[model samples]
Target: MKLRQKILLLAVAPLAVAMLGIALAVRFQATQLAQHERALVEAAYLQSKETELRHYVELAQSAIAPLVRSGRTDAATRQAAMEALARLDYGPDGYFFLYDLHGRNLMHPRQPELVGQDLWTLRDPQGALTIQQLIAAAKGGGGAVRYLWRKPSSQQLAPKLGYVVAVPEWGWMVGTGIYLDDVESTLRQLDARAETDIRQTMAWIGVIAGISILLVAASGLALNVSEHREADAKLRQLAQRVVQSQEEERARLSRELHDGISQLLVSVKLVLETATNRLRLAPAEGAAVAPVLGMALNRLDTVFNEVRRVARNLRPALLDDLGLYAALQHLAREMQGGSGLEIAVTQSGTPRELPDEQATALFRIAQEALTNVERHAGARRVVVALAFDADATRLTVRDDGHGFDVARMQEDPQRGIGLRNLRERIAALCGQFDIVSGMGGTQLVASLPLARPAAIAHDPVSAGPSPS
Candidate 1:
């Protein structure tokens, strides 16, 4: 994978996990909240049921109070009590019952056959006998019982809330009950909705995770492509340097052959001519040929000196011997001699010695700038300055010449090559180069950081003469 993709994945993976965690937490909290809401609703319904039961119980107690106080066992009063009980209709999943002091059922909304049937033989869902317990409580004062109830014909079960009260005059127990299945049904629906919400949240999280992953991958690919292009550019620059180096080497060799061997041949010719004239003139005639031979010898000496000078200019031995400053001074003097132009060379700040590569680079920049001045500038004076401070070494070459527009020259491939090569040389050393040229003159400035000996030792080739 590309670096961008890797970075994107690194960035997104944590976010995905975080989002998923948040979604789970939210779902859990939502489920809890829904459960709480359902509980509240069920409680409200139960409270309403309790209210209804309380009303019925109060009315039934009031109706039976007068009859029980009259101490009447007459059939008319007993019929009126039964009619009053019938008037209180039982709600769905609800029933009302009355029990005598002996725990025999006097009236029941459901299972009316059990009325007046038995004494204290009923057991609740947990097998706890409840009728005798309620009768004992009734005898003491008034009380209630709440437990699960099951009809004999049905398998369905439900929680039941019941309240019981005693009629002391009649020695009877009255109560009402309500099943809790409807409340439970409401809770189940809430649970279902919670599950649905959790699933939806998880789905959204998955989608975000997928998109984040894709974006990371794309960024990685883009970074990889950018790295490739940078590598290619560096390779091209290296190739150009190799070609330029080869050309410089060839020029140096040509200068050496022409200056050294050719000078020797010319000297030999002068000596031969002197010998020939001496043989022809003998003792007396030799004096006449002496002037011609002297002139020839002088010409040969001139040719030899010119050849050596050209060779030195091609590849200066002084560069390695005396260092960059002296080499530049020598070049400036030579340019002044040949071009008849005033060239000024100046040094400022501290004169600390530089590594060979740095010195060579500065010298070459000076050489190329002067060469441009000699070729293109129709000016009379040129100034070359070299300054060194603690941080960096700076070189500037300026000429008062007939300068061309920099933009127009850069647009042409042939004219632009020299400036481009100068830039590349500076860049390789992690330096900066700038050119400013106008109608009157052109100036080239280059600045390079001073490298320590350790850095120079690592790459002697880069520390060599500037490629231009």
Candidate 2:
């Protein structure tokens, strides 16, 4: 390998390692962060479940409250209350259960066989005597406990969180429980989603690292590739801004035509009418009508001048009538009026009549390029070049003024407005767009293929004379 190639490898290898390290670091941080978030998600689920269980149990209490308070201790009254609670069911696997002070089930809503069963000695998988603990908690004013119970929906053992309360006058406990498996499943789903997002982030980091490793020799371009995503986002926004600007310009032009040129033409018309009336109806003759004729002629001249100015602003006549070559010449002459800048035009190969879209795009690009140069390029001279060949057309505008950073301008909305539009225009034609700039000078280059035109005229922004 050449010395340059070897040195390039040495520099690239470490950068590649560093990038891998960063990817791993980011993955680790994401995982740790996601784990903490998972706990919060689980906590939120648990808290909500607790609240719902309390509400459901309260509903059961409300149903049984009237019966227990009726000032009657008859066995029939107790059976009525038990039967009423048993019929109460809200959702799937949701119901009320009752247990006597002695540990026999009173009203097992879904499992009637458990009514007479002795469950005080029955233990869950965790070896906790489930009924005994619940009875103790209920007797001690009422609270909640966790254990394994058969799910009413699936008849499978599942973790449950139950709340129980005592009926002091009736020697019974009433309670309800919510299945905890739902909370677990929800937490698991969140954890799975978090893992998927982390994998995706790691994938993106790997892609960026792989790219950096491959292009270490062109680090600036690599950095620019990362920056290109940001630029693409801005480009989408610029597209809308460019459209709004064109519409605003069109509205301004329309106003000027109506209020400025239209009024002038009306004045000119009135002047000619008066002149014609004087020659026909008045006694004045010869030199007497000469002054009126001269005044009419001056008004006509003013109207003609106004029309040309508006026409040029709408779409340069030279550009439409004479083609790009003559239009560019006119453009240079216009910019050199008061500006301290010398603009030059050069062409190579033969100039042909391009389609309206192609000719217009080239002219507008040059017009905008010159406008930017005159406004920002504090240079003494600028060169506008047009080149045509068998396969493509190219236009370049270079300025000797203190050239600004092309990359910086592209990233900044205020600075890179026209250059961006020039690029989009050329690129629409399946062409290449490039800008090379430094402290000494800046050059904007665009090339369009001769293949059947692909670029449509999207911008109507007349670059002839921008409004102040």
Candidate 3:
């Protein structure tokens, strides 16, 4: 993948995973929260229903209290209370029921025929012995029981919440009940509302996560664009500089040939013409012409040597003929000859052949460093070292000249291009290059790995005071 795509992937992959995790966590939490809230609301609703049923039952108790308040000590009072309860009624589906101590129906206000019938083993829809449980509650000092029964108005089996009381003055059980389907309906409605709220909350979270992801992706794309533009600008500038340098080199070569080699060739031609004319005019003058021929030969030899020097500067023929080591030694010798500088060469480890591109890169780097030492370093002594190892090769060039600030030069392209080019060539070969410089001297070191044909190896060079 391209760098931009890789960067975007790195940025987005984590965010996507985080969003998914958050979404799942929120959904689970919301469901739990809704369920908890529903339970609380249901309790509150059922409590209110219980309060209403109790109030209604108390009203029924008030109606029968005067007849059976224990102060009335007559069988006639008991008969009057029983008849009154059987006849008394309230709103539709609201009534009191009575059972004797023997688990048999005494009076059912709504269903008159059920009076006096045995009801002990009667079961609700869920297989609970409804009449037996209710009789137990009434006999054991009165309580409530939940069961299913046929609601009077609806004539349908529905859940009922009932309260009961035992009258000790007579063998009677008194109870009142209310249908509970309304409470269940209210609970279902609440559950639906909670689900809707949770879903809405989830949707909003999804939208917010989407927006955040979009923002991050946009920022990454913008950064990638900015970096690409900067790289393109640098490449354009380097291309222009390279074109200009090539033109200047061509011009210099042209001038050298025209001024030196061209002039000598013209001189040789004129001398040959004169010798030819003299030889034809007089055979006796042949010995005198030998001097002219010899002079012409010397001039041609000088021109040939000058051409060779220029060619060597362009591309050393020895580099192709004898490999990188010989070429570097020869360079040091030539530099020392011209500048009167003492140059040292050190060799280490086994000599191994390298691929052509690697050999060329090392030679060029050495050539540039030596040129810098000759033109810019003003040094009295220089050292060149080449090491070959089982895994890699290393080259270092050092000079004992007063050094310049390496940082300042790096920021100035015009001043640093030669070094930049050298560094770039090393990088292309996957090799590392470093330069350390100070008042004492400057050092250039480069290393290359043998295993990876396209990679560079780095060997750190220890720098110390220049040789005395």
Candidate 1 lDDT over residue span 15-107, tens digit each: 778877877787788778877877787778778877876777787778777887788977788767766775676555455678887788888
Strongest candidate by TM-score: 3
Q: TM-score of every model? A: 0.57, 0.45, 0.78
Clashing pairs in 1: 4-219, 4-220, 5-220, 357-463
Report the error of model 1 at residue 256, Å: 8.5
Cα-based RMSD of the predictions, in order? 8.2, 24.7, 5.7
Instruction: Supply candidate 3's per-residue lDDT for 125.
Output: 72
Count of clashes, each model: 4, 0, 3
Order by lDDT, highest first: 3, 2, 1
Best by lDDT: 3
Better of 1 and 2 by TM-score: 1
lDDT per model vs. reference: 0.74, 0.81, 0.82
Q: What's model 3's TM-score?
A: 0.78
Cα lDDT, model 3, residue 436: 97
Model 3 lDDT tens row, 1-468? 997898898888899889988889988998898889988987786687677767766766777788777678476886677777766666787788888767798778788778778988888778899988887887887777889989888889999988887776677778888888987898888889988988898898889889988999999889888988877866776788689879988999999999999999999999999999998999787899999999999999999999999999898877666666777778888988988989987777766566767777888888878888989998999989888877778899999999999999987756787887788888887888999999999999999878453432231111111223
User: Model 2 over residues 1-468: C-alpha lDDT tens digits?
Assistant: 955567667888788888888888988898999988988887776788778877888888888789888979898999999888888887877888999888888888788889888787898888989999999999998888889999978989999989898998999989988888987788788889989999999889888887777667687556556667777877777877879888999998888888877887788778777777877887667567777778777877887887887788678987766667778888888888768679988887766546667778888888888888877778889999888777777888999989888788877766677677778788787789888999889898878777454433333332222212
Candidate 1 Cα errors over 4 Å, as ranges: 1-216, 219-223, 226-241, 248-304, 307-311, 336-343, 372-383, 398-421, 432-444, 453-468
Error of 2 at 34 (Å): 41
Clash pairs (backbone) in predicted model 3: 430-455, 430-456, 431-456
